[model samples]
Target: MSTPQMIRTPLTELTGVAHPIIQTGMGWVSGASLVSATAEAGALGFLASATMTIDELERAIVAVKERTDKPFGVNMRADAGDAEARARLLTKYGVPVAGFALAPKQALVEQLKSDGIVVIPSIGAVRHAEKLQAWGVDAVLIQGGEGGGHTGAVPTSMLIPSVVSAVDIPVIAAGGFYDGRGLAAALAYGAVGIGMGTRFLLTSDSRVPEEIKRRYLAADLNGTVVTTKADGMPHRLLRTDFVEGLERTTGIGRLVDSAKRGLEYRRVSGMSWIEYLRDGIAMKKATGRSLAQMAQAANTPMLLKAGLVDGDTSAGMLASGQVVGLIDDLPSCEELVDRVVREAAERIRAAGATLVG
Candidate 1:
């Protein structure tokens, strides 16, 4: 298919991409290949650095740079032990954008902005968006409870407009978005763009193993459930037998499992026990989470790796949005982005034609 005309928005203008779409930095899924493919498709892609070591993150950034010269971004935990070092690395590499889940401190935002990097943080509520705007972030991506991973209780339709009205900065709508119709709806909600995680995670460009991808493809709209059983926070996951079994497990059983996963993560991550404690301390201070919650936090990445990297669904489950039910194919980034833009343009034109006398 031929390339469609660009759909310009504040997001495209701010990030210098041709489309007003963003591929979210999903842990264990969004990597160099996916980021590069999305960038080359004229949409902004964020490398998931929160799942990588500082050195691994640098190499991933280099891998993306080697694959494409298009502008892209990196997403990292703002409260990580190496947060400052990672911020400096973005400046060092001249990355065009830096995406964060937890809002970075104002000083870090200023530091990144000083180097001409656009700072966009993912927020789950109006208050967070307002706070990020006050902190001088370039934009905020809002994901509601229908989204994957840790999410809030509100749905996107209610959350996006609330955030759009509350914050002066551009809003990128996420959660339950998969196709051109969703993009058109998001624009009508006064958002400048849409950010997709599960949608992109199912793409051919995504590095998630095929077996896991097929499992995601097989899910229905009601196939996902949000449970604190995975971690001590609300994480939306596919309701496989393993996950349902997790829900049925006792609290003590859950804690024991969490401890085991934490040890496994420590081995794969090559983080010493002391270093892990330091990182947990930083998280505690940043999130004000309880000690138990923090221990559960360590279970997240390793569990995700079990499915996404190892393709062992019995051991873990897939993180996905409600939109996963609407998706069935694994199109390449180029095919996906192009079709979205074309379909959106057609829909927008059709809407206008209806109003024309």
Candidate 2:
């Protein structure tokens, strides 16, 4: 029995635009075309700026603006040296909401709030939600372990209830969400709504190659694997030969290759040698690693670009949530949103009828 509800969650309220739904920002996949389509479909879209250069980001933002007057958000890297500059661009472009993939400092949240922007950060743990609530975040987007990209061990089944009990803010449940059934499940767990990444990635509006989209659809549950060998974090990726090769390396030459790759990555990212080194230094300080060791770590932009823009899965890590396993077909952004809502409505009605003894 798939029980659903007719409850209109708080996320439906117009925060800065006219949609209750939010499209999770998918790195290279969330370009202008996808963002605009989502916005036009009566949902909020997010432009992924982490994968783009400043100039590319500006152009994409402008393109989205031209395509729709509805509000949209931009995902940014909190640890980047130019993060402040990117934040300022939000004010310049008058973006409706600012969504962070990682938890941001309270100061940045306060600043954005003061500027009248709604601040929502994606979190995987209840403790993180409590911290964000204390930091004055507007809402929390919770992802379960089933999600692709970077995810925590806790599933939405456990995390949503935990966060709801620990905090009083809106919770957006992510991870395995795809259809209305997922939305209904999220509501049952006390989340305000759902945010999707992989589901959207399989849509017609998605810019990834058809073959790649097909690869995701053919995947069944448990197809994704978590590997820390990519970049420095535990990244969920398709079990491909490239990932297998990296996992098998255990020699001096491997370390040297990693260092050389990081250097080349620095050049391609338009970051000066000093700034690149600085980021590495800061990362090492935070992670308790030696500065020199982190200097050999591949930067986020480079790794994401290698897979996102260049589509070379062999080169670096691509962040994906576990929902990729369930996708079966690519529909237009409008069609996808409509199908979700329509299915949700039907589910609501059926459940309501059952209660009408």
In candidate 1, what are the lDDT values of residues 1-357, reduced to their tens digit? 326555789998999888999999999999999999999998899999888888889999999999888899999897788788988989988899999989898999999998999999998988888888988999999998899988889999999889998988999999988889889989989999999999899999888999888999999999899998887889999889999999999988888899999888877777888978888898889888888888888898998998899899899868989888889999999999988988888888778544455
Q: Kindly provide the TM-score of model 1 when superposed on the true structure, using C-alpha atoms.
A: 0.97
Show the lowest summed lDDT stretch of 10 residues, model 2. 1-10
lDDT of 1 at 274: 90
TM-score of each: 0.97, 0.90
What lDDT score belongs to each candidate, Candidate 1 first? 0.89, 0.75
Evaluate candidate 2 by giving its C-alpha RMSD to the native, one decimal. 3.8
Task: Return the top candidate by TM-score.
Answer: 1
Candidate 2 error regions (>4 Å) = 1-7, 14-19, 251-254, 282-303, 314-318, 352-357
